[model samples]
Target: MTPVSNGRPVTPASPGSLRRMAVTLPLVLALSACGGHVKGVMQPLDLAAEPRGNAVVDMLVATSRQPSDNPATLFSGERSALPSITDVAVSIPSGKVRAAGTVQWPKKLPPNPETDFAVVRVQPLATAQQGRDWVHRHASGGHAMVFIHGFNNTYEDSVFRFAQIVHDSGADVTPILFTWPSRAKVFDYNYDKESTNYSRTALEMTLKALVEDKNIKDITILAHSMGTWLAMESIRQMAIRDGSLPKKIENVILASPDIDVDVFSRQWSELGDRKPNFTIFVSQDDRALALSRYISGDVQRLGQINPAEEPYRTKLENAGITVVDLTKVKSTDRLNHGKFAESPQIVQLIGQRLVTGQTLTDSDIGVGDGITAIVAGTVNTVGKVAATTVATPVDLLSGNIRPLPKKKPADSGATFQSESAPLN
Candidate 1:
């Protein structure tokens, strides 16, 4: 069957993808158009992360001689209480986490103790003022950047991932990671939802501490996967509570968000003219999200939201948000679920755009064969699915684009693939 790029499944392709089809997939993709319910599901039992790997070594090299603090908690892991904040010397001078456990996954990534120092877990306070006090005491300045991971992640995953972010960004920003109860064990989807709902109040409270307080100069949020929903909800409510989305809050980067696109725009409209410089990172080839499509009855997800309609596209741009398509710029991981954080190309773009606070262009960052293809397919897609590359946007940081000159294809991050999709 010749597939049209409308996101709806066309007649199944006959034994040929490109050579025999004589079909221009790009034309179909041209019409693609595309969230607001955000979320996460429990990961499988073996989803435990591997040792932090040589991540610590890289961090050491990337360090610019800085001192940090204990991370602030956005949501409590404990049902009745939040994680306690203490001076654990999150510094990785020793290069170890809890003296190493007996078990380990060869490919699994380890946690970054250094992140614990940067995004210090804020001690939850009985009042928002108390939380603000705690933040003020530990911050290097009047701003903070918080990270929240989607489903299938553990508290350990959140910390290490966040640490790498702090180290590489070269920004002296305070980091706070909010970890909801993830069961960490896959397959517990319902439980994960429960945890998400349960943590909403605490998440709101944390945001309140930042938004309600005038002392905070900057507030940034980086949420991946299911965490995007929570982040948006928090921001949406903040807008409702006040007349705007808070001027102190600068950027809100939603990477591979697991959200419903229609819902996103609706909620986004409620913010009125108060745009918060938002960014949406999407990849048509994300396998884990493909799995998400199946589990979600083929619903269009964050990574799959396509910009087909010019009205919505203009709406998004006018609202101060950029949708970066990243179905290309290969990386080292599978499933492509972690591309926004793991892929060097996308990472560089983010480090440039958000960290450095610079402007960018399409050719500056490359993706999807100079264009994007969004197809609905067997996936209950809200828009079309065109493969995209995250590298299309220029990094506001290094100010370098046009694919760094490299000799080795392996070094070029060409190994990235979708790990979650099944042939069946």
Candidate 2:
């Protein structure tokens, strides 16, 4: 029998792999308990420099981390507060752009090794209202996509990754990042969890502020790993306080969520039928989530759950949840946990489907066979086997090869206004 994860065959763990994990697990747990160890101080790049790529991703950041004198040390969390918003100019690299991460500012266009994709400029907003207005102006068609990054991420890591997703996926809306006070260390899991919890109220405030903007049309939240917990909690808190779900939030995508099955179920219950269109990207091959499971006393992590397994598969789908298992999707990363963002095909799917507010389906690059077709097409395209071909599987996989039904526009007149003061 094939080794299975969520009813799908994954690269089976070998005796050697299991042995290695046994040796590493203890070390990781022990180190994680040690918590934050300060890393080298990061410095800001010159903002006056010209961008290498024509695309300038204006990343609006809202963070709960206490501000420090040093911008680089700004993210080391000591306490929580209302989020501060910062407008950052992330310069995308020209030519064949590889996966994006934060780099230094380039002196000229087509950044060389010295300067690559980095946060070149930042303008701080004096008030949350100012930040909301800025986002409103940038929001094409009143849509904003907020990204909540997982644990072990620095401020730079979170911002750069958001820029990469916005750029690669061709999302036309303004990109907002909710950066919690993550110690950004491999050993800081416990501290990170506490910090994430601490930031829930602040994140709720940030989303509330966005929703209050009369011009804001729709909001799409994409959270990864542990960040999913924060997102869900924030959303649930808002629903509890307001007695209804936030209407502006249209799409909620949780990828490789580092959340427990039971906890997620309760959070799901809180939505009370007013939940947004929800999508989950899970993978049995996610070693990070597998480790998370072991660390949580053998409790199954939502991201690694096999939907084909008993209880969960029916429970999730029955509640109108769409779960996509990406165990077979090839990834460039060793962990294979971030395949949702790392894979080009998946990125394209985000742009063509999710960004446009369309639901992903078999007819719309459906999972299983549809995903397989995308992987094959991507391989062929990357290999330059069909460089000149106008008709390719990529388009077919996105359901763009045939005519698609038009979607009705969201009711603009609807609002979530409340007399009660917004949560802080």
Candidate 3:
């Protein structure tokens, strides 16, 4: 099985991969020629565009990446010896509605079509401390959310995505992006992995600085794909060195993590029982993780695991971890891997629950439909498996752990496989 790269798969070179690319490239070109397009509306912002708009999302960024002077390029620079901070305002075209609720690049700011967004202005701070001060001053939620992007992303890609997330989720907290040096090329998975490892210490320092900040009340971390590994390792190091998890760290959310399950378990162990509330968004239908498993010659990846299946599932629940299974959730992306951040429903959930420091359970108004919420409790009996469960929100939150209905046989269940179909 060859792993095709849509710029996110972290797989090594292989003969099959070459063949897959050979087939994929022409198909992609043909689709483009016929007016097919991928990615959301949030286009890379034009550095020269007017800096103001009716709808604007101001983002604060902290990075260990080197800086780029090209107006057309934001952080196209290489890894820096030290971290840097910058602030930018993303302007949304009034009335514009993108297909995926994703931001799109408009030819101009305040685009006429009204359904678009653009990154209009970027200002580099004179010093990292100055940037932190700006974040402190502008933070409306009294807390901060640090977003770490995963494999095959450019600085612009991360910025736009973060902006879209903040806008769509309606989160009021200060947004801090911790971007590593990603080659942003489909074939540079190994390089990207190395970059993550290189950036871990810097990430730890950033977290430390946030915790030590007198104004910042709590810090919530949101990491996707490979970024989850980086985030976890940084926290683990902090715990090891400081002898406990940082008190100010409140929540840890991992979305579609691309880590080995065993490694994830080990990392969880390093945190002990004093860790922050943990939430993981997963789907058995994540095509990217499927390819990852194939490339690594491993059977299980943390993000792709069906938590209803085994000892690991019980382990997670016992720890009071919250798992939101999106296997049956509808998403605009065909890959179904990025739904944690891309799906509108999930985004709403994040805005309404996670970002505001609210608890999530199946009983929440929009939560229980096709999604499964798993938590640990006192009930020990295994319940019959069903596609959806309707437990009281109180039972879920009060630690009344019970087994979810066991899934049907493999032949009747959704198979874990790569999505080969094209996006609608």
| Candidate 3 structure quality by residue, lDDT tens digits, 198-279 | 9989999989888887778888899998899899999977876766687788788899998887677667645633567788
* Whole-model Cα lDDT of every candidate shown, in order: 0.50, 0.68, 0.68
List candidate 1 stretches off by more than 4 Å: 1-78, 81-89, 92-134, 212-215, 308-315, 355-359, 363-424
C-alpha lDDT of candidate 3 relative to the true structure: 0.68
Q: Can you write out model 1's per-residue Cα lDDT over 78-106, one digit (the tens) per residue?
A: 34344322211122222353221111121
Which of the predicted structures, 1 or 3, would earn the higher TM-score when compared with the native? 3
User: TM-score of every model?
Assistant: 0.59, 0.75, 0.75
Residue 199 shift from truth in candidate 2, angstroms: 0.7
Number of colliding residue pairs in model 3: 17
Writing each residue's lDDT as its tens digit, candidate 2 over 77-183 gives 55556567788776667645454322333445433433366556677899867886787678787778889999877776777678778887877777889999887
What is the Cα-based lDDT of residue 383 in candidate 3? Answer: 19
